[model samples]
Target chain A: MAANRSIDNFWAVIPAGGAGTRLWPLSRAGAPKFLHDLTGSGMSLLQETWARLAPLAEERFVVVTGRAHRAAVTEQLPSLGPGAVLAEPSPRDSMAAIGLAAALLERDDPDAVMGSFAADHVIADHEAFSESVRVAVDAARADWLVTLGIEPTFPSSAFGYIHLGEDLPGVTGARAVRAFVEKPSTDVAEGYLATGAYRWNAGMFVVRPGVLLDLLARWHPEFAAALRAIAADVSLLEELWPTLPKIALDHAIAEPAAEAGRVAVVPASFAWDDVGDFDSLAGLLDRSGAGTTVLGDSSLVRVFESSGLVVPRSGRVVAVVGLDDVVVVDTPDALLVTTRERAQQVKEIVAGLRDADRHDLT
Target chain B: MAANRSIDNFWAVIPAGGAGTRLWPLSRAGAPKFLHDLTGSGMSLLQETWARLAPLAEERFVVVTGRAHRAAVTEQLPSLGPGAVLAEPSPRDSMAAIGLAAALLERDDPDAVMGSFAADHVIADHEAFSESVRVAVDAARADWLVTLGIEPTFPSSAFGYIHLGEDLPGVTGARAVRAFVEKPSTDVAEGYLATGAYRWNAGMFVVRPGVLLDLLARWHPEFAAALRAIAADVSLLEELWPTLPKIALDHAIAEPAAEAGRVAVVPASFAWDDVGDFDSLAGLLDRSGAGTTVLGDSSLVRVFESSGLVVPRSGRVVAVVGLDDVVVVDTPDALLVTTRERAQQVKEIVAGLRDADRHDLT
Candidate 1:
């Protein structure tokens, strides 16, 4: 495995799922977070991800999204061929979703290495991200599951931590992964930050398609077999997808493989964000001091003596006054108003809406 | 003048102006707050006011609103016959708007006693309001400019105070108004409340049409003469209205009249609110403890761990979470998010929108 080596056999598998329930009204069930131009950028997150990967995975892009978002995914990424966007029949969690892509890549390209990235994430430095992916792809060729470990800037308890072992012998900036820990408490996170040996596990994985499936076969034999069988017979997808176990890829393969001393991590010093909620969205906008950051049309948001993020997607004027860290997401059919601190609680609102049988709103 | 006596020639003068800018996005320039049903009741504030005054000033309603909102006023007050709604050429302030009504009544009925009330105010007890008005009208006939003084519930500096003097010789609940003061400081207001000799001057004025003209003539002879000319020739209103002074009735008449011992106050024990801002609006729609008070369709607003006022007029689902004293006003063309304490600062947002020349939104 060599760093900065271009591998023509590498495919970029973008898992465009997640309704982003916490960012309600802006991110709806029909139109998820991946489809929104959340950072006021001209391109949607999915489009931005495609743009970032196009140079490396040119004509090797495979986007897997829910059945409902098939047309939207294709529309957002017009450069991709019709067959490039794979529509899942049902939500089978990350393991099945990403596993299905691996199974398909395994059959389509015998020597293919794949780098899996979520469609809704925001990466600031494209050159750094691509360089890290190239390094991970080189490591993937050596029959090792590789992940891009982001250098933690702060002791953030919001994400899982990736523990670093000894440096991978012959690979630059690549280290063997000791273990992948779950989201830690603030106290534990601060200690990990102090040691300077742990990185934020952003769920970015690069691996050989065949190797990933084989690793899945060790822990989730039926799940791997179902995904491979479906990849073999595309007609059986609708009948088989729901039968697959609902599990995130981290728990299904990455965590287990790391514990067995078979995984490696590439330390990348680039800004990465999942854009999980309004608070993260506010940080992305970066308007410090007391004034609102309008993600949509600036003309549509009027603020005075206030600071926050206002997403006015409904073509209506949004006025925020005398508030701190407030979030006003005005969509056509629904509205969400909350503070950045209370952003996590928005998930409860979505759950409550679902429980109240307001499926149209949820 | 006898207390509680029903006068045959009494007219209800409703000055239905003011864009209610502080309540912006809900109250607009074309469709002001007077035309909105701020309370959950099934009638607009204007309609509710008309209903409350129907018993005494039967069919004797004169509504003064901006030319832009003339049609909406007539539409809301459908029972009013042709020429009942008086559209102002421009906003000439309270004095000119109400003075026009007085001039019209003076010529139509020499014995008419006009009770001028704003169309946007809310009163909890209709019976108590009517009783106060009857007494005010009684005092009005005795050559006194009568006002309804609401008993202070709190030391709110938002409204002006009417200093009470010795009790009127014959009229019950009626006393001589020592002076009509401007909005006082909270400390001074608290002191006035402690003394129990001050009452909230709700701007509800009652007076004989001719007597009001004579009072105006004493101060601004040219202004009174211009109003009389417009009344004598109804066709001259469009030409003469712009010549009238832009002064509130309180400064032009009430304060001076009170100093001259020609003003009387009927101390009414009833809840009264102008619905000035979202804070006052929330106070009016009081739902103590922790929960949202929906002024529109309750089902449209879904609250979780929120205690505030949510006016969802756009027929969309409004979800407020983890906020205390929050004000969410979601309308079709605009939305306002603020806290009750910072509600007054909403005016700055409105001003900013206006300065930006987004008139359609304002």
Candidate 2:
């Protein structure tokens, strides 16, 4: 559990199983969001995420994605090998996804620590991020459920917060977890920011197979039983996986672990962005006075004397004349023009497209 | 010649011969602007032009247009009998076009008063326009070359003005033309508006077979000789029509006639709009304080308090968010977004397209 100790035998499990309807048009049912080259960089979100972890544990990397996206995941990450694309059976939430990865990884190395990462977040400072993961890995090796907690850079109400208790007796830069809080209101977020003892729960985690299995068995017996049943017959896992309960890992496991005094928080100082909404991408982009991000080969022909516009697609020129704080996404088939503050309501456009049966575009 | 005289044998010679690059994308080289259903009202400019003149002179209407648009012209106006579609050898200007129409009509009736009308001008009051044309025909019959002059409704520098010297001794609403002024500066346009003695040269004219020929002989003898030779031989006319001098009737004849004291102006109180530029259309459109005109089936879904939009096409909803005084034209193939005052410079876009060799679009 020391700082420089090699977690070389660790497996990086990316539960890339979400349908990701929030990023529609660019991401259709056939091709999910993770596979899309959102940044117009050489790698996709999944590829970038995999590449970030590949150096640490390339041989032990596993991508647990939905059956629909299994081939795409495999095709996108050629470095992962054929067996690394673990196909999930159904559209269950993060709890089942994590359990499936755990069960599959236990077959090869039961004592190995599984570092879980979301496929869609953008981490800018790789070295700092890797160091934070290493810190979390050290904490995980000591039989404590470890979570990477990003130091809040702003009063963000979008992400849940992890309150730090008194420092852990032996672990340097690691805090004893006090409590896990849901997404806060603006005032509450400001209050949390002022306290300087809160960190954004980035949904990244590190836990040994035995520790996760024990936690799941004690807290969510049904999910643990399903995983056990799937492990018994690997060939029939696809058929049985759809019937598993849909629940987030944070609600079913992380929240309970923190409540029961079994959680450790690794204070991550790396530049991290969940990139959950257009507004969230502001930090990752090069901003002008009006908060405009012209990613890839894009040029802002004319932004109407206003601000907060992010057009990420390449070879596309977008001119938001007279608009302020608006997100205008000009894709091949559709264009989305919404206020940056109302970016959360962009899901409504997806819903509208779905209700109109425009699945080809959606 | 009197106002009440009926000119029964007159033929409506429509010079439907413009390669209107000003309205590009929608108006391609293959199908010029006159063929575009701009209003989406189930009729093209050519169709509406023919319909407007059909009541005044049926079956005798002739449309001298470019060779490429002959089929479209025929298809749109099916009632135009065989040989009514006079295919121009090439896009020579209106001087040659009018000469060709005059010569063609002379083949059937030497005494026929040619009432020349442009194929694109829109007359909102058909009855009044017809009466004005009747008065112009009477003046033409009296040996004075006649032009319908629309009384100025605004100080528009976009159009030429015809200054009246005095009311004709006997003919009602007809005046001796003093001079023809070119498109004026702002001050000159204001002065013309203030005087109330100037009228927009609506480009509609009535002349006998020899009137234009006599003017051409006196002013432009070479042009007169070329037209005479082309008119005498059908094959020569076909071969040399495109290579003939490219001059507008205003420059080649009207201005000359006014200078030589041979022109008469008939004041037209009718609502006449050339619809030459976007601003002209704005005047015709029902405007709110914001200067938006929502025509046809489409709605102007302006968000963020956008203003001054004109949706002239149908079957598609156009949303202009956070834009002011900008014209957004959404066609099946192209979308044009420009400022209202700069709409006149849309011709520059057409010129650019031509320069780029996008003949399919322009």
Candidate 3:
């Protein structure tokens, strides 16, 4: 209940722009994963993300998304103010999307500490997530770029790792980030896990708007200046957006800040998932460890001697029989069938469709 | 070219009434396998069967189908005369369906030699098939209930085996049928294959109409009498159809006649498939041994590192990735996803759907 109180001068910046190609047919260019209710909660992932952050960052939200998705983002979160959603003209990647929000928040509230979380990730235990964000916010007030580090549940080769250093002197449960490592091989991830000093870098960053801009300016001065200029003119976004570098926030600011010893990590024991592929999705939905895990209308799916994921979105009966760990995603126009282990290769199909000039399906 | 010529007084009796539970969604109760184009040949199985037999039977064809499917049968075979398709009041198994045809042929043509072939089977070599039917007809003229025995392509346990006896005294290319063995284990089938005295019984029976009726009478006197009574007076079909025995033709006549040394078989080297399940259906379509054998429009299917059967009948793009021997059948009302190995279990799903009163899907 303590985590329900709104943090003073804190803003939640959500970057909602990923194609999520691995979840093809269900997650399309026109309707990305954030727009879909993958968890059968009757709420899209974007709406769930907004609900989780509203209590802590009450009425202080800035959702940065692609221009094509701006209207959808606003529609999903109707309570937000007029200027709460920032529309990027094109895909400039994570750095430009988040940094632009930081520049605008800095101009509106000089003392604003912004927490940037992706709009499509799944989080369990909202109280623990809120508590971790609270600690990260406290560290952010001390002029440090703080990230909430998730406890590694497995030796996953798909996620980057945050090397944990000594605990911060004054901030409890917050540690200095020794380094931010890229996604490693499974063997290397196992080594990282054995040391007991690495946490999953879930890309949840909290920092004062000025501190983030200054860090970006330290590495790429023009990138920071362009974003600040866009925030100043309000009309310069179209002119300056194409000029900004396309890079993830992790590479643009987090890694460099960690190397410069200005990054802090708040260790949190809460379940978090990017829902990267069908395998991860099956795990998330198959909590009972029983029959097929249906993400959509359960009435639409009928399974016999099968245990995996079936998303029946096209209002048809989906029958899965005698296949284990299979993935079947049925939409109105396109359907995907694969195994959990081979789910990552779905992106190849999407790419092939695009190359074949079947963009209508892609 | 000899196979393209019509045979004198030869009638093709097509019994087109199987649920084809294994090929669900694609083959439903309202639309069985005989009404589908499983071979990607731009024609339904019934149409293909009619085309194959038109040369031999000419206009002498009798297609016995359930009353529910009579309209579809007539629609598929538009060239058939008004009285050619005989609609049974309900299903009384193959015995009643084919026996009624035999009784009608006997009344219409005293010397009619009827060749009964299922409306939903796939034959690769048309010339060889016609040649085999010719030999079977020759044997049928000698008062023998003749069956076409397909040479064993593999040790298949899914089909009944025909035990080949000594050569017929006078009928060239035809031999005595010693016995009919039910589906056996793989090891038992392998032994049957090694002996070189067994063939897969595809249930192609050739015989004079009176001879067939006499053979049926020898086993089930009431069943034969009822069929004859229905044929004598068409008005009695609705009253007597349900009273007829619900048994397969093999059980009612062929097995008993073989035991009495009254059955003969024409050895056939042509390819034949019942298409009983998705695995068999995949084999029938994947002639090139290539990626993803699509039964419907190939343009609607996209595969990456996957091979098997994909039927995209619902006009949806079906994409398969990193799975081998997978079976995906998508229809407008229902969809089926499984592996070729597990395709046999699809019937279990159909049975479950029927049990749950989801007849709309079944």
The number of the candidate with the highest lDDT is: 3
> What TM-score would you give candidate 1 relative to the actual structure?
0.92
Better of 1 and 3 by lDDT: 3
TM-score for each candidate, following the candidate numbering: 0.92, 0.77, 0.97
Worst 10 residues of 1 chain B by lDDT: B1-10
Candidate 3 regions off by >4 Å?
A: A288-290, B1-4
Residue clash pairs of candidate 3: none
Error of 3 at A127 (Å): 0.8
lDDT by residue (tens digit), candidate 3, A1-362:
35479999989999999999998989999989999998888899999999899999899999999889988888889999769998889998999999999999999999899999999999968999999999999999999999999999889999999999999989998999999999999999999889999999999999999999999999999999998998899888888989999999999999999999999999999899999889989988876656788888888898988888999899999999888888999989999999899999999999999999998887
User: True contacts preserved, each candidate?
Assistant: 0.87, 0.00, 0.95
Better of 1 and 3 by DockQ: 3
Whole-model Cα lDDT of every candidate shown, in order: 0.89, 0.74, 0.92
State the lDDT of candidate 1 residue by residue for A205-228, as single tens digits: 999999999999999999889989
Model 2 Cα shift for residue B143 (angstroms): 4.2
Model 1 stretches astray by more than 4 angstroms: A1-5, A78-89, A107-110, A220-244, A287-290, B1-5, B225-241, B287-290
